[model samples]
Target chain A: MSLIGLISFIGTIIIFLLSKKVYKKMNWIILSPLLICPLIIIAILLITHTSYSDYNSGATWLSKLLGPATVAFAVPIYKNFPLLKKHAKAIGLSLVTGSAVAIISSFLFAMWIGLSNDMVNSLVPRSITTPIAMDISEIIGGEPTMTAVFVIVTGLTGSIIGPLVIKYIRIRTSAAKGLLLGMGAHGCGTSKAFEIGELEGTYSSLAMIVAALISIVLSDTFFPVLQHYLVG
Target chain B: MYMKIIKIILQIIFLYGILLLGDGIARLVHLPIPGSIIGLVLLFTALQLHIVKLEWVDLGAGLLTGELLLFFVPSAVGVVQYDQILGVIGVKLVAVIVLSTIVVMACTGLVADSVQKRGAKKA
Candidate 1:
């Protein structure tokens, strides 16, 4: 690899690790490693006038790891199977409903604001985890990079507001609390769920995985029909 | 310690093999879904059937999933390429996501809670 590649590669890891420590110490939403690390990297690339391709030359390998990570999702989903089995009724209904609501509402809002068809497609899967969302984006002809941004923003916003919504609504059950965070924000929501309680965290992670599956099915079967009606 | 490291490496390789198989199936069949997702389903099914033990893949899968954020950081930063889109409608786009997130959170929580309450009442 070129010196630039090595620098970008090592720099990304160092920044990410440092930001993780800062986030741990600060425990602030704005300081989240996901949001902060990327922001800092982007700023550095911009200020130094380095092109994205140069940075990505080394970073693409890291990005490709997402494929294996996607398969790895099965582990958590499998481990959490018992939780799904326990709250089978509540989880099944709520997540299906939540996933539907997430996709439909995102489409409607995007259309109402007059986003392009491709942009609408990207927004539809923004509520799911990044890997699956990007995959769904590509399958549906959306821009995967744009979809990633939307997913991250959704996660950040969802985690920030998820707890407040739970508190205000007086959502009592750990199952409901978990599903809300997981379905609403994906990974970030699951972490926040952990802060609230252990059971909430388990349920949240289960909800996140199940919600991704639900959204995938919905995107394949339901979203196209909705798009035809609204955009056509 | 060396044995543990080797075990994880081997398990990861096994998982990667499933991923390859899934990609092959998707290409052969021309499935609309992505291969990784298909791999996820395939792995989940294997684990459920006890064909692939959870203990076998658990540690390796856990490591990959735990670092999921790092894997995507490059792609997320690729957004810098879309400065034109972000310049024009970034605020509106953020608005849409924030609004939709709030709606989904409230709706999911309320619906799930109410359903659980009804079930509790009946029982």
Candidate 2:
């Protein structure tokens, strides 16, 4: 990477760190680093006429670190294992059915709209966290970049409308409400759950991780059958 | 301070080693899931069996998780490449996402709520 690219990468991280502070301080979802950092980086790239390739040169280093970071998720999953075991049946059943509903509906809708195969696969995993969604998208021949956009949009939308929907549904427990948010909105929703209560945050975090695992398993099995059905 | 730095670096190497082992096994076995995920499972196992202590790698993993979102920023910023492609399917993508999200959220909440409530009654 060139000197400018290195500077750009460091500068982007610094700016994103600042935006995250603002996000936490203001408590506005709009200021989410997930939303703002990308916008800021893209804007800088555009204004400076730094091509995507040049920017990617330095950015790829950060991306490479994503692998270890994803692996690190095991720590939290392990920490929560006891809670996970306690509610195993409910969480398991909820994840399977929720992911099924998401996959089948989104696939049918995508097919109905005549979306290409890649878009269908990508859209199918939009509800998962960004890293896992991106991985799933790539494995299924979808665009990771598009997957991120889809994830962000889906998560942001769910976070925005989730409370109203939950209120109308009258879910009696914070755990239940958190499950809804986590499965539907992922990282974005889990953060929102943190605002609601401790139990909500715990369930949301658990749901988020469990839902990702369930989605991966589902896609592994469902993708082959769906592929044959959709394109055959 | 010096020992702390070394410990952090060693833990990072441990995590990275697991990732590579996962990649190797995935290739040999033709696993559909990604290598890092497999590494995650292996690491968890190691911790459970006392093959690897949590303290050894927890700090290293914390370093990764702390700025985990930052790692994704570069790739997410790759959205610029999809400007034209998005213009084509943007509306449909948005619609599908919106509809599915609502349905998933409602159902998951209802299911978890009712299931737990029933379990409580039974116990």
Candidate 3:
């Protein structure tokens, strides 16, 4: 039992490494590791008749590293602070407006479509990164697991349509492109930003983090009450 | 080679230490934010304050954060556990996520672009 778990855990790393090469060869978003790696792992487990619980005993190690990796995100943010500092005023204003719009629109849209209040609440934190979004979802009385799903779908949405949006919209600046992707898509969007350029990646990282902080304050302190009044 | 290895190890330790400190403060203050984010903020402050140098963490941060998506797999697989819940509202949820993401991206891009253009004009 333990052996299967360990093998499955290590198998994830090897598969991911292999997927990277596949990604390089295919060069398609549909074939990207984020979508593919998980599918492969799930397939392997299903074939072997290994329970998700058994497979996860080892997989949890990789998951645990996520927190520290998030902490490490500060390094790049720190390195890029100087460039971001110059646009502090712009970043500040845009982030506030963007975050507010994300929360309000998602909440209203979910409600308008006749979903439950809890579903709307889950959608509220969908625009931000997973770790922070999951935390916010709990505070706002949304389902964390559902919130994660929303976050991934959001990222996938951005990854698919992000470039088209940029090209047609004529955003014209790397900064705006970064912010658009980061604020809308979160981590995967940040990945797209890097693909565009260094400056875009930096700006997207800033956008992601700023939007995250704004959501934390609003969701934890105010969103629960807001949800009650709006939905009730 | 040995010195380089030590440097990398020390860098990871420093980052982990920073993360722990952030976690402690967050627990103490009862902040709504995650410890990792607080750690990011603290690390940012440390960088600005010159409490730590950028080079110490450059490699480690790049290596880890570059592959950040892998860490998200476990939580994502939780979707498998939610088959029944998903069946109820999966279609609507997907619609909302797709449409809302497009709108949000456009709105954010428009706001940032207009503000940045104005900033440039002023400068």
TM-score of each: 0.86, 0.83, 0.91
Candidate 3 residue A195 Cα shift, in angstroms, is 2.7
Best by TM-score: 3
Per-chain TM-score of chain A in candidate 2 equals 0.76
The better-scoring model by TM-score among 1 and 3 is 3
Candidate 3 wrong stretches, greater than 4 Å: A220-229, B1-10, B85-88
What does each candidate score in C-alpha RMSD?
A: 2.9, 3.4, 2.4
Fnat for the candidates in order:
0.73, 0.71, 0.70
Q: Is the docking of candidate 1 incorrect, acceptable, medium or high quality?
A: medium
TM-score of 3: 0.91
| Steric clashes per prediction | 0, 0, 0
Off by over 4 Å in 1: A130-145, A191-202, A224-232, B1-7
User: Which candidate should be chosen as best, given lDDT against the real structure?
Assistant: 1
What TM-score results for chain B when candidate 1 is compared with the true chain B?
0.84
Question: Residue A141 deviation, candidate 1, in Å?
Answer: 6.2
- Off by more than 4 A, model 2: A112-118, A129-178, A185-213, A220-232, B1-9, B85-88
iRMSD for every model = 2.3, 2.8, 1.7
Tell me how far the alpha carbon of residue A149 in candidate 3 is from the true structure, in angstroms, after superposition: 3.0
Predictions in order: lDDT: 0.83, 0.79, 0.81
Please give, for residues A65-87, the per-residue lDDT of candidate 3 as tens digits.
77677788787777777888888
Q: In model 2, how large is the Cα lDDT of residue B10?
A: 88
Candidate 1 local lDDT, A1-232, one digit each (tens): 8888889888998898898899889988767777788899999998999999999988887777667767877776677778668678888899999999998899899989999989888888998888778888987789987898888788877878898899898999988998899899987787678667767876777778788888878888898898788778
